[model samples]
Target: MHLKLIYSKKELYFLKSVFLSKVEHGGASQLCYAKHCKDVLDFSASLNPYPPDISWIPDMKLLLEYPDDSYYNLKKAIANTFGCPPEAVCVGNGSIEVIRTYFYATIEKNDFVRIDPHTFGEYSLSVQLAGGRCTVLDDVDSRVRIICNPNNPTGSILSSSELIEIARSLEESGKLLFIDEAFIDLADERQSMINKGISNVFVSRSLTKSFAVPGLRIGFGVGNPELIEKMEVIRPPWSVNAFAEDFAIKALENLDLLEKSCELIKKEKIWLYEQFERIGINYVPSAANYILLNIGADASLFSKKMLDKNIFVRDCTSFGLPRSIRVAVRTREENLILVEALEKCFQ
Candidate 1:
């Protein structure tokens, strides 16, 4: 009788089935595992809708050859933009590459802390690959959290005061804090931690997002010079291509372009938010370019339904939120298409 008093096992089987079925197609170019899909009003990626100023492309062609050791000129341009020394900036193919380097450099086996239910699946994969124990900070211990200013998937933004408090706790605890601000460019730069010179905080940035240059694959991580130096030691020789470095140097020169683009996006983001509010869909307020909405209990089904009509969106089921969907704002027309598609789905 005592042995037969346990709970039923059907729930265990269902959990196991869901876990086993979670597989991602990493190498595919298209969104949400779909190929050759048309009528794409993709709100999956947070990249800028506008292209970069290309007035200097012809002159930049000279840099199509090999790169120098220092990445001096490129570094100088970035330094000027961030108001840091050239050495403080460690560039990479993408900030993701820099993230891998940091995990290997700063963390050892049995030493990693993560804030639960966040983006960057690769971070967990990298941490495990490096033989580190991944511990998550739950709601109970909100002090030492590694927040994503405007968090991905859910798209909720923490206030600057909240972030500062967490940073202070991590500093007191002597733990590392990695803040991925890849989508922050879509918001007010004044609200960013980088602008505040927050210590003990390593901020990873991706030009691929706000510049619409995912093809170029350029990004950087800013932190203390000592940590950045260690990361640079682990970085492969010539990790960034000549073309990417060249393009980034020139892109930095035209800072006005990025500024103007962000303004345009801010306007579009407000309009898109209004539409979402009007539709009565539940969405977290975002300071980033994307919005995450709870599209009822059948989000995966709704996402597939939208894909059939050729509009791609990020289904957050993989991120442990089955009813949530994350969508990036593009042009006014593109956002309208998504609104129409979602209206049809709900109807």
Candidate 2:
């Protein structure tokens, strides 16, 4: 009698199906892929319009050597800027990578994770990828809760105090809370919960949004030493390239740049809000560097119409708001052009 034969990880087939599920993120990738990058005004990415100046050219000599797996200096830089010990920092290729590491470290197969709706899709996707189930509602049995602070798409935020309380509540029940503060540097760092020293709470941040260097892909997590150590052990060595490490250290040294960017973004966001009101475009007031608009029409069509004018905005269907679009707060010149394009669309 023949026994059942073992095969490759058949589980990956389900993972593949999960990957095939629809999820869209806005950036210049589409325009670049289509060879229309230069003339296109991209409002899809929510980033600091003005990034602090720094020498981005990496020393070729450094590239000749392998990056330090420990990234001691880089951790020191992050620790100084974020009020965490170097041992409390877990670095990743991007904040998303850090999210994946965290889930892998804590999530068990079939574990239920509580996730908010209409936020960054990555939270749900990452949990599912880690053999966990994601639920939009809070279930008594759920062990983890994910939140995108200064939330994407909606741009809603919870105060540091509000979130600290939630973290404590979860901690008492032997649960964990993960906050994605990727936008906090561009929103209000004073509202960040990174300094709370909550053992069961994890906060992930990225230079992608605040430093406007998505290509560099430097992101990190802050947590108690025990949790950070687990994630660090699971995170692959040399995951951060030489150039990204250098750039991230430089960006941390110039934290004041965030203040300047926030000031300018606030001014521009207000101007955009006024324009939206005057033009009869309904919009949600945002606490971050982006605005959510209610277009009263199919967002995909509105976005395509705007694209015809060489402007790009985020179609909200992927975010589960089919009648809305999200626009990034940009410079005065670009904002004017965007308003002009909108007027033409309405006409």
Candidate 3:
């Protein structure tokens, strides 16, 4: 005989509804294309088309051994890069893991988490998963505020002074602020709040986009030592794998390669913008590696048309921008192919 298990109504609802909801994201080439489509070019995800040279492989001995539970070496490397104390760094599997950790560390049940409407979806999803409420930035009563610098999809950015003032205001009001600077390396690093030593603010940085190592999944958070310590408590041990830790350490030592990649991205961004102008495609000016195009109707059909040619772009309907599509700056050759494909779609 089978024994019946029991769950509370609230628990059952969460399991059936919240947990079952599908999560959408960009850079899903495997999902968007067939297994054998080796020629598929992805412009949906924002990543440095030219990644830093990581030719050397990790030591075989390290692969056999478990990663450091505290991720001490990785944190030290990130601290040095950002010019902050190691105590102020908290490494994670990715920026998304750090984001969820922040929510778990700070939010109590039913607490309010404020975010800009068009920012990353993870901010809202994380808050909801933690049993917290999500509010818009215009709302005055949130317990926490989260912003994505050089925001996703739109690629809009807030100035350093503007971010500082927002942090100060939130601090004065006894609220927490989280600034996601995942794309800041591709933008202006000088405008980053990572080295600001702001007590009430936490800056989340990703190695995935800028380093072009999304598969390795490395990210970190910088904040006051006390807050970092609190996040560390809730973060799982060995959350960052051995390979990722080694990769990040090596990547940090070679800053020149990252700089070169960003330079290429900036140049290609200009070319892409000019192509959009020539094609009479409406787009938002971007500070990061991606631009948002206003396609004048649902972007699904346009995206499908491009995908048919082995080119993929992000459909921004889920971001509440129904008529917009966000495309990342690719290599000159690749961008030209996309332009020609888009011309056909437009015609």
Estimate the TM-score of every prediction.
0.84, 0.94, 0.94
lDDT of 1 by residue, 85-124 (tens): 7777788889778877877777665555575675656666
Residue 288 shift from truth in candidate 2, angstroms: 1.0
| Model 1: worst 10 consecutive residues (lDDT sum) | 19-28
TM-score of candidate 1 relative to the true fold: 0.84
Measured with C-alpha atoms, the lDDT of residue 94 in candidate 2 is 92
Per model, state how many residue pairs clash: 1, 0, 0
Better of 1 and 3 by TM-score: 3
In candidate 3, how many Å is residue 197 off?
2.3
Q: What is residue 150's positional error in candidate 3, in angstroms? A: 0.7
What's the C-alpha lDDT at position 178 in model 1?
A: 80
What ranges in model 1 sit over 4 Å off?
Answer: 1-28, 31-38, 51-64, 138-145, 195-199
Candidate 2: where are CA atoms >4 Å away? Answer: 1-5, 8-19
Q: Which stretches of candidate 3 lie over 4 Å from their true place?
A: 1-20, 32-36
Candidate 2 steric clashes: 0
